[model samples]
Target: MKSGPDDLAIHQKIQISRRTAGLLLGSCLVRPAKVLASADPLTNKIVVRSQLSAGDPGRLMNVFAKAYRGEPITLGVIGGSITVGAFATTKENSYAGRLLTWWRQQFPRCEVRMVNAGVGGTGSMYGALRAGKDLLSNTPDFVVIEFAVNDNWTDGEAFEGLVRQILAQPNLPAVLLLFMMWEKGGNDQEMQANVGAHYQLPMVSFRDALWPEMAAGRLNWSDYIVDTVHPTDAGHAAAARFITAMCNNARHADLAGRSGATSSLPSPLHSDAFEHIDWRDAAALDPHENQGWHLDFDDKGVAAWNAAAAAGRIAFDWSGTGLVAVFADPLLDPRRIRFRIDGASFQTLDTLKQPKRPILVLAQDLTPGRHIVELVDDDGGSGRAAGQQVRLIGIAGIGLKDDWRR
Candidate 1:
């Protein structure tokens, strides 16, 4: 709730603009002031700045109609830190929670279930790998995808692949693309916009709705943004407002009987090489030997391994052309591991740099076949020394063949 210098500057500019508007109107030199006050400024701006092209509601209208008649509906949200409610005081104050609240208010008679599948510091690459097990398992009737900021570190191909994977689900859920912004006004919303257009998905943009207000001094960045990237409680509320407004528009608009089916899916705008990705925890795989490793379970039921001693080996077989090893890269006193695939050259994965998050990946692309993978503790024969504790979390496979571990 502390206003920074930038907030002060914006406040001053807003006061000046208001004074000028009042003066111009007093002289009867401007349009009627009633027009400005007729609607909430933020809501009006959102409608005008909306980036929704191909405004077909598809099966979303049908789902809304069902909900209105007291049918059960599930809403799923997937993304990175923003979706995880990083800066929000609590998960209930996050945008996903706010949106769910609105849905409940709009359809009080319906049973609404919400699944928030958000992982911090990850992009579409990881999202694509985990969607099947994490988000799609809920069989959502409606899903909101928010990866604009996170996808900045990824390419359009990966982003498109994630979108396609969601759309291709057997449930044929109504998918909405949400583009969130950073405080410094940087995001990959435009890049993902191309993919949204290709699929004619309803796209809501927080940046498009709020950036203009911020620039014109009608809104201050500090009023909503908590940091350079994450949103505060008020910021999440604003995002929820924009998303709700978009959905309201879709509800009121004519549906034209368009079904949100994969049959209508257009050709991919970029390669969906990651469409077949799958994720598995290290503990889930049957290890060839326990050696110096032991499984540790977190409160959330996620399993990780502490390979504090050297020469720990765990072997598994997977049929995939490419593989990515996911592990814990601690911020303090990190460690390293030597990974060998089918007796290939040993590749050392060092966690010397501070990890932005607990999860990290070491990926490789190989020829398609059943391959053996082994991880060896490379702590220089020292056991749990200052920087010699390595933890293995999970692994993800890309373009896996039939014999791939399920």
Candidate 2:
């Protein structure tokens, strides 16, 4: 709600074009009348609802100051399906894409790169594990974090861990936490908001911006949400507007004499087990022994291992306490694999119920040292149905003691 003259000017300049308004109404699953009629009712309320967290103009001011100087920068977006543009007709209609467009318009002379690291159906748990390889590899200058809908109270530790990891980066990237809502009013915004307060980071809640209008009958759920979870193209536009307002507000913030804080690893609010995780595809492993295993190339251009028959196995040495096996979860019957660590008892992981890019933890928190791992085919002679097969895609490990080759 706090605003200055610059903020007002920025708001006045944000004009939603007729074509975008048409897209909002035309692409809606509901009737056009129901969406367009109520659109203006929530216009002013949107900006009022978007508030700066306890920490206004934190590191964001520094990023904007740099952009004002026309320096090239990279912005990274990391989250669940919403960040992945699930229900949006095209990538350009997604909130991330729209935000990039607005950024280009604001700083026409500066070069900006976009890095989207969203994975559908995954929460901050996997995001923290993959942040180093997937997102930070680009060395972004700013990062937008959105997992309020996907992360629950139980995952607060992982969520905070992700924040700490990003803040710990050498680049000292400006961080923004975004809270997206669900159709039935389900999300963990409060839990995430508490984490944001702990770190003094900026946060914007779409639920706060849109839900009140919906409850008061000024806006309907059909006006934005596509399904019960994902947002429609119009919904994405609204989200992009909220984020754009946030950035504009940041651009005009007063950070004249404040000294920026140094980037360092802070005391963790939750378990930071995934801070040093690394992933290696099956083809990347240097197997000391292999039997009955064949290299199968997938349509995605990934080389994976297929167990031709039972008892097929592969072995390797790793130096991590925690280990995770990544596999392709098919719709039909899937193959099973038995894993043994340091010659311990074998544990079988069934791929039948693991839908779409399933990852199972093989081991964790062992004494930090070199350990042997063996994987064996455990299909159990149950002949797969037609077009059913088990595939091993990759393995990821956390708390590695030594530098591992990719």
Candidate 3:
């Protein structure tokens, strides 16, 4: 019998199209077996590093207790979907959920309460904005930040703001930055490392370790990631394993033996540079039915696009005539789209004109360079559909290049 899209595998494939899938890959679905190393009773002191550097001979015993088995320590986790476990079937199955479970098991006597503060598509700007209420309000003993995957655009200035908010808590919470990844763009790990060192904090680079593991058979990339960007249940488990291992190692360090010296850790691995964009709703552009305009091809599936159809290109470019548009047919609120670019902003061919329908203008006259562009609904305004009112078909453009065709 032939299988249909209703198959479990097929459904999993469809789920990967969302941004949530990418961030939630490394939770706790795949639990790696623990290898207990014999404890060293003589080891007492450990040298603690101010940041992500190699440290003194510290004992991981206490860390293991604190992270997994210690008393009812309240851990507050904040970030985008990764912390929320978007791909996971439920919140209880998320990394945060699993970590709390492991903490309970590791320290049977301890009570663990986890506060999850994750909002999809939000950046550090949003993280900082909500820290007081979402994170600090609970007075957590420790906080973990995982904005690396969702907010690579966060810079030193943003880091300062985030740090200030996190430090404002009365407990002087221990902060852990877990650097995550996307398919491409700016070195997100680098950004995390810089921020971590500036704050003299502990940092974990899943991207740094996972890239090499994916290359080796020790770990399966497919088990962890559904796409180049997101992770599968297996992938999330792999992430959980990495975090567990790191925590285990930290606990095993002999912190009592170290007098008081600190070391510097290397910056997290850098990713390719990406043109940063702050999503916004733009006035609709003219929808032309000109013969010159035609839909083109796009590898990334068009979900929140102006229109979607396999028969035609989901996007288009005008042939040097200087204009084009993906008109809002049904007129949905929060009508938004993505336009990838390599350099600066491009010229808005229809800057002077505004159409009755909703649309976003992705210009082509800005920085001259390579760029991948896509349009997505910014989750802003709202409207209903009238039997496919939006059109992704190519309408018109003034001076577009031949290479711009689908």
Candidate 4:
């Protein structure tokens, strides 16, 4: 894929020690913080009440009820650079972090857990595939999804599938959809809102609440937003305020402390292709590589195998269907890479195409079973005497039938 303005990748530090890297990878969340917004909240005509499209609040209210009972609650957030705290600097300064702080403040007695599963430069297609591995694995009691900026209108099914996957969790976690916006006003809310409505979910929009202030000259976009997509701390704080407003509604309006209400998930909006998806990070897979290949890290510090010659090789195993190979443009070179699934003939893919990320569906309908996959660098031969390259990031796939609905 080609790197451009849209790819506002949050490049994590790689030179840090393993201990520091573990925290960066979200192994363990830090303690409660006194982190505050860098600037004061601005006054505007935007209505917080109107910004919330309340669907069935049964599940959300349950979370509020549980918290009041002093029970533990886990909060999860997944998205792109914005959710990962791009321009906000630290996680504690992020909108997600601000939301977590607001939660602790509301219920001081309850123990709240946080899982920040945001990897920059990724959209819902990748989110759907990695949600299980990252967010759901923590068994969060409540989750916030904020992919509005990273994903486009065409990502409806993948986004819907991500929601279904989280809702289908055995623990019955509550899902909240959050919509962020661009400096000039653009987001995936219209398309994403369709999925939210179908499932009767609690949805909040920062754009609806704050865009008018920018458009009407009541608020300067430069003062809040960092660039085209990422937001400054004040921008993030404004968005956090919208989320807290919804949470407050869930606590007070969704029936003050009594909630045993149950709700069934609606049928699929498009296809349930992502409900059982899983991602195999390059680091965890420990792929075997040739001498011609050098190891690297993606923007998120996840392992990436960089091929420097045609003889470079990478081999790994992945199961089920909807198989995808995620390539990291470590060198940003327009090169070719070839691969084979289950010993099938090698299929060639040219890297760094114009618009999309180098995420390819190697096999969309593989037989539901384990499969062997291998990649051989298709750059110039080992003796080419050139160091140009391509990098293999991670591999993901949908699960098998016996793996349950999720």
- Per-residue lDDT over 1-406 for candidate 3, one digit per residue giving the tens place of the 0 to 100 score: 2345434443343233112212222222243212111232111111011123322212223333354434567778888777878786666667677766766676677777889998666656556545665777897776778787765544544444565556545555656677666653223665555555554555555565465545555455666566665666655554555455445444434232423233333332221011121221122223222222233333543222333422222222223322224343424432333333333353222342333332323443543222343333332222323343344533333223335432
Clash pairs (backbone) in predicted model 4:
none
Tell me each candidate's RMSD, in Å, in order.
8.7, 8.9, 16.6, 11.1
> Residue 143 deviation, candidate 2, in Å?
0.9
* Candidate 4 ranges with C-alpha deviation above 4 Å: 1-45, 49-52, 89-91, 256-260, 286-301, 311-315, 330-335, 342-345, 350-355, 380-388, 403-406
Candidate 1 vs candidate 2, TM-score winner = 1
Looking at model 3, report the run of 10 residues with the lowest lDDT sum. Answer: 41-50
Q: TM-scores for all candidates?
A: 0.80, 0.79, 0.49, 0.78
After the best TM-score superposition of candidate 1, give how far the Cα of residue 214 lies from its true spot, in angstroms: 2.0
Which model, 1 or 3, shows the larger lDDT?
1
> Which 10 consecutive residues of model 4 have the lowest summed lDDT?
9-18
Residue 22 lDDT, candidate 1, scale 0-100: 33
lDDT tens string, model 1, 1-406?
A: 2556744654454344334333322343135545755654554434435434423466577678778679999999999999988888887899999999999998999989899999988887778878888998888888889998886655686678788887888767888888888865678876776677667677777887688788889878988797788898988987887677656655654243435433556777876657767677766766755677888876777688777566778776766777766666542333356777788877665532324444444544677767778888756644365653566677777776556646
Query: In candidate 2, what residue range of length 10 has the lowest lDDT sum?
Result: 13-22
Q: Residue 29 error for model 1, in Å?
A: 27
lDDT of 1 at 260: 40
Candidates 3 and 4 compared: the better one by lDDT is 4
Winning model by TM-score: 1
lDDT (10s digit) by residue, model 2, range 198-288 = 6667677788778887887877888789778788888888888777666655554433454445445556655565666666777777776
